[model samples]
Target: MKNKKKIILIVIAVMMGIFLISGMLKGKSTVEGLVGDPKGTFVNVGKAVTTDIQTKISATGTVKAEESEIVFAEANTKVETFLVEVGDPVKKGDVLLTYDVETKEGLQRDLEKLDLQMETARIALSQLQAGSKQSIMQVQTEIASIDKNLLDVEDGIRQLETSLVIAQKDLEQVEKTYDVTKTLFDEGLAAEKELDDAEKAVMKTKDQVSSLETQVASSKKNIETITMQKSNAQYNLDLLQNKVQDETKAQNIAMKQNEIASLVLQKESVLEQLDKVEEKVLAPIDGVVSRVGAKEGSFVAPGAELMTIINPEKLVVEAEISPYYAAQLETGLTVKVKYNGSTTVETEGTISMVSPVAVQKAAQDKGAVSTAIPVKVAIDNSQGLKEGLTVDLKVVTSEVKGVVAVPLLATMTDKEDNNYLFVVEAGNTLSKRMVKQGAADNHLVQVSDIEDGDIVVTNPTEALEAGMSVSYMLLEEVGE
Candidate 1:
């Protein structure tokens, strides 16, 4: 029993020793496994490469024809037949439509009426001119006759005055003789018959003087009447002279001439239309008809819309951009365009125009209004483009070639506002390097102080520090 008990204790002690050895071995194995594993943070890394990069502006645009024309009716007419329909290709000077036969007949009638009106106006103007000249001549003749009558009346007045003077002298001598006879009769030295005869002679001389005076007064009255007649005739002549040079007559002649001119213009216009009636409406440009506004057997007024044509070969893309880019947008900038949601239909283009002003537009999502500037891009190759097709555009504002560049995620900023990049060094250790950033695009940034073939950490966390070790996978190896 003592030997057995001793053997049991020995076995127990041996089991305990085995357990202690196994525990020590297990602990040592765990420590060795941990020591064999990667010792730091895991990260993805990319290489700094030399490449070409561009700063691009993105925009949505619509394809449109560069050249378009709207046709309008030149005169009032009815459509006889439409020679072409919408979407029909037409060449320059091709007949587009025809006018009704009655339209030409109406124009001819209008021309004839205009001719008649013009002829009537010309005749009236001629008559007015001839009458004006004849009236002036008649007034001149009347004035000459009045002047002659005035001269004749003046001569008569002078002659009557001379005769009256002679008769008065005779009367004075007879009165003196009568007085002498009266004295002789009173003294009884002369006969009474002689005194009576002297008195009678004196009375007869007085009557003759009175008659001469009356004749002179009558002649003076005749002179006054003749002078008044001359004045009236001269006034009439002056009126006729003024009328010949008057604005009223000139204005009447001008009115007649203007009326004739207007009638002539109307006649010419009608004749022109009549001449073109057979030729009909012609296309003004080589293009495809896009819209038709008039129908057959429909009457249209002058200046009404007829149709619209667009030249599809000359295609352009129109877009609106934010006004914030107005200063940077310019003509002749290179552009890449795509249409119809296509990826392979991209074509090169150039900016043809940029609006100098901003226009207000409603926002696509919020319905708020904002200002935008209009822009147009001329397609270099329009093989896959069509009118009114929506397109995507990327305008290259700036570009750099053969420069050291890296993924934008590889860069970081510090509390001092300094820029830096964590470059993967030998043995998977980090080396923080200061860099000056230049231009940047959506995914890559142009950087200085970084060499080509350098391995940079694409995503550096805040815990990452300089001289810290890390386990990394190459972006290319990871297929990212």
Candidate 2:
């Protein structure tokens, strides 16, 4: 038991010793830097004076394709065949798709029908030209025949008049016989039957004479009608002959021909439509099929989309700038672009176009975002550029020449509204000097109170105080 107690006591003592040693080690490590001097000491900063200063504004942007387009089909038709797929290179006039053969053949038939219709229209137009030469000749012949018929009618009227005169004489003789027989019968010098017979014969002769007179009158009227008709026909024939002599007839014919020509032109237009209907959709430029909106057996309406063709060779980065900065930005600005884990490249671009109106960027929601108008930057062909690359844009806004400058670290600002820095004098002693500072950048600053050859202490908090002694060190050697 005594041996166990001794061993326990020894173990407890060793534990206490280890804890104390660890605490001591941690304490020494934490406080060692505060108690001792740093392995690397002060940075000696030199005063940089004003030279030519270029003012610039920085902006971040992305690259996009300079040229892009969307294509569409012309007709609503079933897609018969798709010739090319995405990424397939095509040339101008290449067939993109062939619709169903049935539809195409129908269109061809329609075109042929249009041609036939045009021919028929031409024939109809030719017929519309009135009074051809052959028709005029036939009219003249008919008029001559009518003249002969009129002469025959006049001769028939004359003969009927002569016959009427002879009939009238015969009727007069019969009337005399009837009067004589009637006188004898009244005086009892003749038989009653003889008087009656004479009276009957006279009556029959009178009726015949009356019939002949009516025939004569009818013949005269018929002759007059035929003569007038012949005169009218002759007048028509002469008028048509005169019309043939007039230049207006030719003008009429020409006018008719012009109408036919117009119809022919209309027919030609229809034929062109037919031809266009059968024409296959062809690519206009050499490019890849960037987008496909058509498939086999799909109906494409008029101006329907088929596929998009893009030329990757003509690619550029287009950027938009705000109108507020538009006055400061001009054509031919230098730019730097970086892409795909690659090193940044120096390039210059020109302002291709600028929108007069303010255009909002993607970050804009409503009313004017920064009053920035859209501006396009044209990529300089001298630099090889690819699409879809992000770029950093820097624009020089203003420039100043020969200005005094200093390192930012060397300048100090206090609550008393004074800016100053520690300067190293000739005897290696530090002195506090008030300074006036100006515009600064990531690496350089413009200082007003320091001379060109003055030495300033960067990190003045290290051990710097007014009238303190120091050793001369080059800025390069001190790693400032």
Candidate 3:
């Protein structure tokens, strides 16, 4: 029992010693924590730096293809076939799709009508050119013939008048003989039969004279008819001559040529229309079809969506900038583009344009407004860029030399739009100093009224206040 009691006493002492040692260790840790960070906070420090500062206009933007184009149906038609799919690469002049016209019957009817018109014009022109001259030539030949017949009729009339004169003189001589015979027979100086024969001779002469007169009258009538026919022929010849004059090359030939030319032109025009109606839509540029809006057999209205093509290698940023700085932006100014969610991946570009007008972002809220002007930035090297990606924009407007600069982390903002910083005094106590910030690129800004070599706390924590005790640090000492 004595040995067991001694063992219990030893165990109790050892347990008390272990508890005391643990308590002491815990107390030392509490004291160390107080010495290390009295306010349980971390202080980030940076010095007021004197350096060159560049001012930049900041904006947010989205990636756009340099040559993005939206294809639209140019006419009302049904899609015959879609030759490309979404994401398909296409070259310029490649057929994107074709149209199947619903008005095929109407088009065919129109073509037939045009064909008939052309045929009629062609036949009419040919007849005027060939048949008209032939008719005039025939009329000229007939006129010549009529003129020759008229001369013949005049000669026949002269011959008939000579015959009539000779016959009349013979009749007169015969009548004198008959009278002489009658007188002689009555005085019994001649036979009766002789007298009768003389009388018969006189009658024969009278008949001959009458028949010659009838022939002369008939010749006169024939001459008159021939003269009238000759006059009619001459009038017809004149008509033909006038027709020839009027139907010369300047008239008939030119008219025919013009008519044919007009028909040909009309035919060509209608053919072109038909070609357009049945033609395939070709790609106007080399790109990938990012979206296919119409499918095969779909009916579309004029100017409706067909597809969207975008070149992945050619990209630009359409940034919206504050209207205050928009006037300072111009083409050819350098730009820095950063991917919206990326910190390291970035590229340099140039300002392509600045919009002249400001656009409201939202409806006004009792005079408070948000508006911006569009600014375009062109990226020289656009590899790995995608359409519609968000981007951060910075346009370096001007550079300033010998300005007091510091990290943006050191700045604090108040509700009044004023900025300030916490500067450590000689005894390591912090005092607030009002600062005017000029230009900021990213993490650094040009600060006014802060002298070089002044220690400014970069990040002020909740543990800090005016005239508070703090541990000191130089950021360079920590490899930060």
Candidate 4:
């Protein structure tokens, strides 16, 4: 029992010495310096510095011409010949192609048909005018003859009236003579034969007066008939005059004139079309032809695209950006463009437009489709840019200068949802700093309540606590 107790004491002493040596080594290792500390949690660190921080959105883009146009066919016709090919440089008004001969001939026939119709309308109008004049002259002649007959009937009635007046006086004289002869016969101083003769004379005068009155009445009737005929003829002349000036004949003339005018307009339109089909198609602008849609014998409909032209001097870069940056993307933002080719070309640009709506993009990973907004950047100098070339674009969304910033990794969130960072304090201790984050990029974040040159733990661990003693190496010294 005594020997077992002595062996137990020896083991206890050995164990105590081992524990003391381990503790001393661990204490020695925790000393702060350029070398790392083993007792403290191993972490990466960065310095809070005053520097400019820019937030950028990266995207791939395609170079495109800002001025591009597609020339189209103006009429339904077949292309007879192509005067220009793809990649051909052309000036405004230069001939690009020609139409088929059949089209020109068809237009010429249309023009000739219009001309013939117009000539026929003009001749019909002249014949209508001549007929109207002849009808008017006939009616005027009839009215003049009726007027002369009326005047002769009136003069005969006047002559008959004068003769009737003389016969009335003669009848009065004969009545007086017959009364005298009867008075003499009653006194038996005149003969009976003489009295009979006086009575017969009175009766003869009465008959003459009645006959003259009848003639005058007949003449008056004839005058009335002639006057009615003259009135009818005058009415016909007025009607004929109205017809020639403002009624059917005038309306017919107007209709013929309108027909002629309509034919004239049609002819002009057809002539213009004929001129176009006869001449070759001209370029509307100065550009390089990028595409030709028709061959020499191909038929094209009206408004069909014939070729595409692009002005290379005007260039822009088009890119698709995520909706996450929609609020930041807008016109007038600066952009950096890089074209990776046999020789990389670098240039500066500005955001010219941002689409208000979003478009669905194909699923790149065979997953759900994503949405992106299109943006255009106008290059300041397009010296080395070409149409349809793919390029890289860096859009500067936000920027700040002389601000206190730290690595994004240095920030942490507490249970209260406040942002805080582990800043290295004096004596190599950690102090939990509550900061107000202003702007953040992918790598750095702008923070308030953090001083410049404050060493901050960029890669903090879960076990890290505030006020804990730490042995740290400067991030710069560690080349991180």
Candidate 5:
């Protein structure tokens, strides 16, 4: 009976020792956490693993062709010919169409007529510039002839005056003689034959005076007619000279300029007409015609989009990042892009632009902190993309490799704006450690105070405090 009691006491002591060891193991703590039974106050936990962490923001955008342009015809005309068809490749300055001669013939004729008129006007102007010097000479000669004629008229007038004067004097003398003779005859102091002779002499003198008067009148009329003729010639010469100086020359110069302007307009019009006459649709760039809206003989107007061309060679994936995350984005940052349907076909790109403004989809929605900013990702392998394709873009705004970081849940902020972490020390108790924090993308924050194997508490609560006796469990093991 003594031997059995001693054995039982030994077993009891051993059981007590086992319990103590177990309790000691459960309470003992390390930087990571206390090594304990898998259950205490059961709480989910995460590890502060060394990982190459990347800060990213995601947005939705469509693939756009790099070079897209719209072409239009300028003139108001119908399509006359089509030199190429849809999907046909075209170069710069290639003629797209040719117009029917019938339609343009009328314009051509009108232009020709204008050309003739313009040329005639130019010739007339030239003639004016020459100033009818030959004609002027002829006029001067005629003027000289008129001057001579006028001089002759003046001379004749002078001669007629002199003749009139002479005739008047003779008549006076003859009258006196006749009066004396008649007085003698009436006194019968003279012979009857002598009286008869005196009568005849008086009659002859009177007739001679009448004849001289008629001759003078005729000479005066001749002079007056010659003078009138000279004046008419001078008037005609002046009219001709004025025509050469003013009307014909000026008209010709004006007409030449008009013709030049018209020719220029016609050239432009022809080009415009040829452009409108084109019906062939060609690829705007070295691109794939992704869409064809109209076909041959289709009636279209300006600004009407007929087809869509996508230059897969130049593609960009546009993304709309939230304003909150956009502040971290910048140009020339690397990006990872994945098509919505084909996530496996991944491509790399670079950030081309970061908008400074924030955007919101709905009026009532909370505006994104960087909502107004447009984040463009220039895809390197743009040839693999198509227009209107949706892509998922992950822009690596920042990254840290092998830095001491804690899960965001492990951190707590107090009213004093102090950021701290509850780190497991000795005896399953958490010690609050104030840490200088670095960048935090979202759920992870970088800390300089923590080391590679430091134990940080996850899911911190108010009940947790410094130097408090707390039971804990190991949620995750440290990874290399």
Candidate 6:
């Protein structure tokens, strides 16, 4: 109907325009005929359209990636090189940047110095033990060798003494035989040759005894010398043990070991520092590089942002909803997410989760603070959505079937906090009636008092009091 009226108006305007331009028709007469009489004032009106008022919960939020992270430098250093640039896709542990490591050279020098110190300490300990021969094993070996030699000497002395005793007995027997032979020869019953043989034998026996006695005496002296030598060896061993303990050799060795350990610890500390100095920053998550905060060769402090990575394919919408409807909206419910841009884009999603805790959003106009519960929606196909894109959402927290409802603007509150609206009667007179309000969205609301197709003034002004007659322009109102 509106399009038809526009066509008729355009045709009439063309006719009037042609008539005035040709000067053949009187313009004043045409003007007077078009506007002959004045009309009374008319108030614009809207007919309540009978429609299903879905009890939806609406909110505005941002599009966020499920996997996202802001990379920061692990340590304070100058940026050396960026291995990847913005918009480049990368995996976890991929190198994003490297830091300047001039300090690593200094650390290496310190490590080298510590290495030299450790080496010197070890050599010093070795030198302290060199040629000392003070160990118990060494002393024990010396004593044993000396003792064996002494035993050999003593055995020789005993064998010589036995030989001497045998030699002396044989000499006595020969002497007696010689005396018997001499007596027999005097008696003329023995020859002089026998007596001479007996005498020679006796002399030979005496000579053998003399030689054995000399050997026995020499063996005895040797035994005495060997015993003295063994005793001296044992005394030297005991002296070495006492001297070693007095010198605190064991304590000295332990001290040297501790010194080397200290040097080793210092070396390890330097190496750890060097590792940090030459550290390479890696991507924390597998994602595309969305932002590059620092360029190559730029200096950055500790915890400074380097880049941002986000998995664009995995997307979610996070919205702050009123706590009143937060409980009604839970996970797995269908949702309509509208991304506002040059053109509004709407996509279907499911409620992923709803937070139980409330967060302070902002202060209301009446100095009352408002709290909101965080809610997340998972998009089925997030192909066109990107991270951080602001969007509007319509979450179907509830649904009322076959119910009477009206525009939310039609409702008002009295001092008693009762909800009411201006209901237009047949004569265009307004009447106020209390209404039982149910779930409401930004547009329509569920009400028990107002039935379907009821005419209610959406924009009731202060001048529109109870029982006042109104000249309403039907279908829609043009006034603000």
Write the residue-wise lDDT of candidate 1 on 1-480 in tens digits: 225434544564565457446546675334221211155655557789999999889999999889999888877789989999999999999999988889878988888888888888897677545556676667578778877877876787788778778878988898999888889889997898999899899899888888878887887787788788877766545545663456666676688888888888888888876775553889999999989999999998778898989998889999998877777899999999987554458899999999988899787869788888999999999987778788889999889999999887777778987778889887678899999888778778989899998988876556679888866544545554
What tens-digit string does per-residue lDDT give for candidate 2 at 212-239? 7788778778877877876766654554
For model 5, the run of ten residues with the poorest summed lDDT:
36-45
The C-alpha stretches of model 3 lying farther than 4 A from their native spots are 1-46, 50-58, 101-105, 110-275, 340-345, 361-370, 398-403, 407-438, 441-444, 447-452, 456-480
Give the per-residue lDDT digits (tens) of candidate 5, residues 317-409. 777776666557789999988885644568989988777666655545476332346777888986566778888888888888878788755
> How accurate locally, in lDDT, is each candidate?
0.80, 0.64, 0.75, 0.82, 0.65, 0.73
Q: For model 6, what is the alpha-carbon lDDT of residue 464?
A: 58
Compare the candidates by lDDT and give the number of the best one: 4
Estimate the TM-score of every prediction. 0.58, 0.45, 0.46, 0.58, 0.52, 0.46
In candidate 2, which residue ranges exceed 4 Å CA deviation? 1-56, 101-278, 287-289, 321-327, 342-348, 361-373, 381-385, 396-404, 408-424, 427-440, 446-453, 457-478
- Clashes in model 3: which pairs? none
Per-residue lDDT over 167-274 for candidate 6, one digit per residue giving the tens place of the 0 to 100 score: 888888889998899899999989999999999999898888888788878877877887787776665455445644535655666788899888888777777666
Runs of candidate 6 exceeding 4 Å displacement: 1-45, 54-62, 69-80, 91-110, 117-266, 269-286, 293-307, 317-344, 348-377, 392-402, 409-434, 457-471, 476-480
Which residue pairs does candidate 1 place in steric collision?
none
- As a TM-score, model 4 comes out at 0.58
> What TM-score should be assigned to candidate 1?
0.58
Q: What digit string (tens of lDDT, one per residue) describes model 3 on residues 33-152? A: 222234423355678888887778878889998887898875556888999998899998899998775545555677788789878878656555555767567767877887778778
Residue by residue across 1-480, what tens digits does model 4's lDDT show?
225434544564566457446647777554344434445544557888898988899999999989988988876678989999988999999989888888878878888899899888887666556657776677677787887778788888888888889999999999999999999999998999999999999999999999999888888888778888887766556655663355755776788899899999989888776665644778889999989988888988768899998898889999999998899889999999999888999999999999989999778687779999999999999988889899999999889999999987777777887888898887677888899887777678999999998989876655689877765565656675
